[model samples]
Target chain A: MLDYKLLDALVAVIETGGFERAGSELGLSQSAVSQRIKLLEARLGQPVLVRSPVLQATPAGQRLLNHAQQVQLLERSLSRTIPALNADRTRLRIALNADSLATWWADAIGEFCREEGLLLDLVIEDQDIGLRRMRDGDVAACLCSSDTPVAGARCVRLGQMTYRALARPDYLRQHFPEGLTPAAFRDAPAIVFGPHDQLQHRFLAQQGYHGRFPFHLCPSSEGFVRLALAGMGYGMIPDHQSLGEVKAGRLADLAPGEGIAVDLYWHYWRHGGDFMERLTTTLTRKAQGCLTV
Target chain B: MLDYKLLDALVAVIETGGFERAGSELGLSQSAVSQRIKLLEARLGQPVLVRSPVLQATPAGQRLLNHAQQVQLLERSLSRTIPALNADRTRLRIALNADSLATWWADAIGEFCREEGLLLDLVIEDQDIGLRRMRDGDVAACLCSSDTPVAGARCVRLGQMTYRALARPDYLRQHFPEGLTPAAFRDAPAIVFGPHDQLQHRFLAQQGYHGRFPFHLCPSSEGFVRLALAGMGYGMIPDHQSLGEVKAGRLADLAPGEGIAVDLYWHYWRHGGDFMERLTTTLTRKAQGCLTV
Candidate 1:
């Protein structure tokens, strides 16, 4: 059996990004934390952490981290039933994409979080790649576009978010003086969320242009809309996020009838406890009202 | 003279994350890109990149990247004057915090970008640590709270942004039912932008509490406001962002009359040419109108 005391030290180091801060978080001395790590490595017969360039978990460390998180989840659920248990408000570390957070996520889960007295540690990632966070054992669960689940995880569809190619009217007048054309797309700058985001590429390809084009890379979802409204670039913005701006005439659809619907899924450990089960129920119920079929 | 061809290959590799993508961006074959990197490495007599785990430039590679970006800036300025030269619109890579980007940045610079036909590649970072992006040669310039300039960089004050600890009225009623006290603060859940963000810590310390407390780790500035509105936790939000909500009585200040003012400064290369110079002027002049001193 592995010792959780040592695992707690490892979790602290990763979360706080250093030994000193981890020591403070765990209420242990720096040297004591270091000793615990050493003990863990000796017990495992391999190094579990990579300390140079950046402090990150080795493959072995990641598996252990996932186990620790699962155990923590179970404990929290147990505490709810047994009042004598610690009952400290537990934080669930989860990975999610920004578009959802900016649009419907907080509204969907906020009430449940408040009632359950649960705190969240949210890691923002692109929807297509967010599953890697769960695969890497860095998060207990993740909301991503992928329907496939990791080995021990289960996934459920949570509806879809529809996106339209949007731009300012003046921007269209300036860049697409002729209307949406292959030539216009080749010349007009586009706003991409990030390097990992392929929505713009997919949208452009769908429009029959697959060549190098000028683009403005704006990572924040809110900033992405701002850039479009500012006439900086045309981009794919979610319907939920741009309804008001679109109605106000601050933004207009570049392709009126053309829209892309990205399917969203909730991926969690199959054995994740009553808390996870209830939270899943809450998210599904809320997402249905806000998201499209 | 150093071979710009080799340098371009290095820059493209870092920006695009691989040799194949670099080839596509630079209009060269994959092997051509690889050979250039090898030739550059041979000339430098050391590795310019760390390929394992993640693709990032080495320290020497970073210096070269900075040099290449500076050269690109100079070339773009020259091209603007001499239109026969390549007049392709240039994308300026800059680092800035999310709060500024969400609030004043887009509005302030949107017009300038549109007029100049410039595209932006923005990197979102915390204000306190944004300078490291410039130091590491990861960006052409950055907006940060520190007035100090990196070596070969010039900085200009762009006024200050004021933040207030804010929460929903009902959240305050539930968490601080007995008025704002040290005990109440110790128990109330707080929202922190990230681990690197010290705004909440500083605000709590100012209110005379220096102990570990529960906080929701939310990285998105927009989401942070949403969480506060959803009654998840109280957090320090910029006055510009929360003004409407606060005035509408959806959210209220936890500590009235107390505000933390973070000074904003524009840091850019000293010889960054006309583009950087004009950008600095525009930011300073516009910041005065929107940001509080």
Candidate 2:
């Protein structure tokens, strides 16, 4: 088994970007930190850090870093469960998309972390690709829209996040003065999440309008909504986001009852660590409460 | 020179995730798209797409995608500038952080995209590391804190984004009822952007307090501010985000005039694009107007 102290040093070095900053975090001298890493490399039979342009962990080092972080999370949960050993708030690193981070997941995560006395370390990326980070051990768990599980991980259905195809009343009036049609889709602009974000594209494909689509890409969950609100383009708006505007008729749901629902899944490491279950449970409970059943 | 049609087919295959989807985007049969990719690969003597559990571009493929996208962007700009040739709006992929997206950058980009009749495809990531995507040809340009230019990219100073360490009035009264101290930092929660995000830790280090610091991670720009407002933790709030709230004394700036100012830069490709200069100029002008120069 690899020495955890070595792994800790490796993680710190990669995270802080250098031995000096890592030394500061670990409360060790720069030479002391360097010695630990060297010792680690001696045992592992390979250099862990690449230090030319900038300091970063090698692929092997990243795996170790992710493992060490997982162990740290487990220890925190152990302390919480035992209620005897000195409780240490460990960092629980999780990956998620921008939309979920901005929506229901934020509060639910905060509440769980506070109660368990754990520190959260989130890795935000596109939902379709967020699982890739988890697979590479960049994060312990991930919240993704993909229902299909990767090998060595457990997937739990967190219910569907319904998205209504919405546009400002003025946008529909100006673009499709007659009504929505396949020809209108070619002319009118559409709001997309990002390049890799396939939600908007998939929605269009589901609508059976297969042609060259004009679209504007907006990054944030809120930013996309604002762009759609300004009548820049019609977009798939998450149903739970805003009730007031839709109810007030500020935005029109082009296809009522035809809301495209993306079923979300919480995928976590199947083995190792006690906190993953608790974290997963809390996220699922809170997510189900917020999402469409 | 590679056939633009084949390159377009390759790009569509990678971005849209599969041959069928790319076929739909390009208005061609799946076999036709596949044939184009095969022809391109035959000329290059390498496979571009990694067909497996997921569809993604090979390193060589990413380079070609970036080049083709750049060409498409330039052609669109040429059409706009010339006005005689019919212009087709193409996606202009750029990388930036979420904080900038939520703040003043969003509107500025929107205006520019509209004026140029171009589609915006933003690759959202942290400013410090977003430059990695630029180097990989994933984006035409990136808004980053790094002043050091990459080999082929030109960097322009966009001014400093000042961040005040702030919290809700009530959080201050409850946690550090006495005042700010080293002990208080150890106990009180602080909001962080993400795992790779070192802003909060760096702030604490600069404050001359180096110990095990407690922090809560919130990914989104607005989400973290909201959490800070909800008294979850004191965060480094970007100054331009809400001057009114700080002015009204709702969110207390824990350290006045001690705000951390991260200098921002616009780094882009030096050649093969006409609109990049315009985009960079508009961004720099708007950013300088809003940031602390």
In TM-score terms, which candidate is top? 1
Tens-digit per-residue lDDT, B194-250, candidate 2: 656767877887788877667776778877876676567888988877587888877
Return the top candidate by DockQ: 1
TM-score of every prediction relative to native: 0.90, 0.87
Share of native C-alpha contacts between chains A and B (below 8 angstroms) recovered by candidate 2: 0.41
Instruction: State the displacement of the C-alpha of residue A2, model 2, in Å, after optimal TM-score superposition.
Output: 3.3
- Candidate lDDT scores, in order, read 0.85, 0.77
Could you tell me the lDDT of residue B186 within candidate 1? 76
Alpha-carbon shift of residue B171 in model 2 (angstroms):
3.3
Model 2's DockQ? 0.43
- In Å, residue A271's CA in model 2 sits off its true spot by 4.6
What's the C-alpha lDDT at position B104 in model 2? 67
